[model samples]
Target: MRSKPLLRVRKTGALMVAAVIAFVCAVPLAGAMWQLTPVLLIPVVVFVWAWRAGTDVYADELRVRALVGSTRVPWQRVSELAPDAGGQISALLDNGNVIRLTGVTSDNLPRVLAAGGQQIGHSDQPPS
Candidate 1:
């Protein structure tokens, strides 16, 4: 059995609500023609993506899940956690690859670090 995650960060529940609304709106278009029924798949896909895609932080690794696949990054491979100007967080790896952490924002980074038993440090001066 797998151990419980230290943190499971998911997209906002509001996306699920939006997906429902989109599905409801698409019903009319889908009803217009049997051929158009496939239109309904759009919202279903979005709903499933919103429901399944996220980051699960374990003690030994970080599992980043998408609609179709997931990538596992061992903690030792992560060199740094950096946030972009948009406030989305990504992990810079020891080998120089970067992996965006789904649903992790600058605001919640401290919480994530804490859950992973990591420390947070800031530089007083701006980076050159």
Candidate 2:
């Protein structure tokens, strides 16, 4: 059986800020004047964020869908995977490409390391 990659789900700060702004803006329309059209955009944005956060990074391929665009990176090109203090994971490519995994948890870190063919004791700090 093929080993599935680690999946990370993280909330984007920008999305949270946007939701707050949308909520504030929709306050005035909260009464009988409320319509799902204007406020509906917030849910759409949240859904998009949720989808992006729940991306999977496997040994065979890296899949990402974010603000810029969607991309796939094969395992052969992946160089490194590291985690930052701010709780973000960075995937380094042999071609000098770096993709940040926004919502990576400790639980999922092991799977990511395994997919990358890296041992657990390879890092002094923590794996990305």
RMSD of each: 1.7, 6.0
Q: Write the per-residue lDDT of candidate 2 for residues 1-128, one digit (tens) a residue.
A: 64655654456567767766776666666544666546756655665665555445665676665744667777677677777776567778998979776565565777766755656655587757
- Record all residue pairs in model 2 with backbone atoms less than 3 Å apart, i.e. clashing: 10-103, 82-128, 83-128
TM per candidate comes to 0.92, 0.59
Poorly placed runs, candidate 2 (over 4 Å): 1-31, 34-36, 67-69, 115-128
Residue 70 alpha-carbon offset, candidate 1, angstroms: 0.6
lDDT against the true structure, per candidate, is: 0.92, 0.65
For residue 33, what is the lDDT in candidate 1? 95
lDDT of 2 at 45: 69
lDDT, model 1, position 119: 78
